[model samples]
Target: MKKLFFLSVLLFGIFSFSQTLSSTLNKTTLALGEPAVLKINIENLQGKDVKSAPKNELLPFHLEETKDEIIKKQNNYTREIEFAVFEEGKFQIPALDFKIGENTYKTIPYEIEVINTAKKGDKISDIMNNKEVKLGLKDYWQLYKFYVLGAIALIALFIIIYYFIRYSKREKNTPKVISNKTLKDLELLKKKKYIENGNYRLFYVELLEITRNFISTQYRIPANVLLTDDLIDFMKQNNTISQENEKVVEDIFLRGDLVKFAKTFPDKETMGADFNDIKDFVKRSSKDIEFENIRSDV
Candidate 1:
């Protein structure tokens, strides 16, 4: 009786540990393109320490397999299969074979529905048309804006440089003042009637300006800013003027200063002689200057 009872218990335990598999779905019905996760649970593998199992390569109809996550325990394994269904219909997922060790397990079939949300029941809606993006100035500017701006900037820079060169050449060809031009200036000053009006101070002032302008241009000196004595000293130091010219300059400068500052008035005869003396000096100095505008004083 003890042996028979032990045999019955062993058979019952073997029956209790039989292979089992079940399939479930996270969603029953879903919109087209939506995901449906199907889970498969397996238990009680026949071989405890088996080496490997056959690969089950079959997938459900009309369902795209997105992912398959498997969880393995001591005696069971669970698989979560994520799928995206595009076709609109009811689908019965057929039973799949799961070969674990030596024994094969089967999962119960599942049913899921997929619907098209773009249309109502039995009424087809107009599908969206393809759109063509029209390109405008702003869009084209975004593509080539750097090259356009750089070209404009370069052109402006070249224009500025060109004008600057032209201006420089013009200035280089022209002189501000020249000794030969003093004759024309002196003639204009004489036309002012400064001496005839008994304005000896004004006359001397105008005459001295013409003299200074001539000296500054001819000798490349800032004679307009120099005192009369300083000017004479600089000329003497540099031996730029002859003795006769120096004497004439000293006499005219000293007398001109007296007339301007001390209110000393000169007669018409002395003024005329002083004016002729200045003309003589200019004529004598410009003889060898190779000036373009100088005319012989008859």
Candidate 2:
């Protein structure tokens, strides 16, 4: 009977020692990319409680807080340490040592292995069943002809708008100023009396140069290249002169050339007539002139 009692007490002490320092893992084999839960359970069965688990350095994997559960009857505290290993490999969990009062308890080390997924022929696994997505029938596809037509229309519209703006600006900047001289000035120019002075050639040259200079200053056109015919044609094309004005201009040019190059002397009255034609031309075109205030010498 005494031997039996001793055996019972020894067995109870061994069971209590096993409970004091122990660790366990919840899974035996974990797949790659899956979580494996390792739990280290330590029981403070001694008379005093020390600090919680010792501070650890930067670990290979992540760890979480330790959880505590109390057993009132045993006057014991259990600390549950949880950790996860996310890769596929054999991993060893180090032993955890705890100091209670002057006594120290150490837990046994543990290890685990993670497995990889199986391969199949072009068929996705059951884990990725919901990842296959399909396109709907309502998506839009623009045709090449539609794009080309739109581009050409846009280009044509731009060209038309550009030319319209350019021409409007050209018309606005076009010179409208002709001679702004008074009728009295024209009459005075006619009465210069070149034929009476017997200088018909000088008279024709001065008259032609003055007319060209006036046109040059008024219309901003270079007078050097313009022949009498070209000037008449331009005036007609631009509707600058009436038909009567053009007829008078032609007669003046003919008489001026006869006296200037042909050396045919004109009578004073014929000279006066040509001069009067110039005066009338200036008068008729005066209203068409756009006046600009010329800057004067200070």
Against the reference, the lDDT scores of all candidates come to: 0.77, 0.61
lDDT of 1 by residue, 1-298 (tens): 9999999999999877876677888898989999988888777754453222232234655788888777777777778788888889998888777776676667777788888878545775569867899999999999999999999999999999999999987665344435448888999989999878877888999999999988777655578999999988887886555566667777898899999886677898899889988887777664333332342232
TM-scores for the candidates: 0.39, 0.33
lDDT score, candidate 1, position 65: 83
Tens digit of lDDT per residue, candidate 2, span 1-298?
9999999999988887654655566776767655544444455454456444543321234332233333322435555444455666787666666666666766666676776775656665486446665645433223355677889999999999999999987765444323544344455555776667867787778777776676665555555478877877776775544567657766776677777777678877777778777876766654444222231222
Query: Model 2 shows how many backbone clashes?
Result: 0
Q: What C-alpha RMSD separates each model from the true structure?
A: 21.3, 18.3
Model 1 error, position 245 (Å): 2.0
Estimate candidate 2's alpha-carbon lDDT, on a 0 to 1 scale: 0.61
Query: Which residues of candidate 2, in runs, are more than 4 Å off?
Result: 1-192, 288-298
The lowest-lDDT stretch of 10 consecutive residues in candidate 1 is 49-58
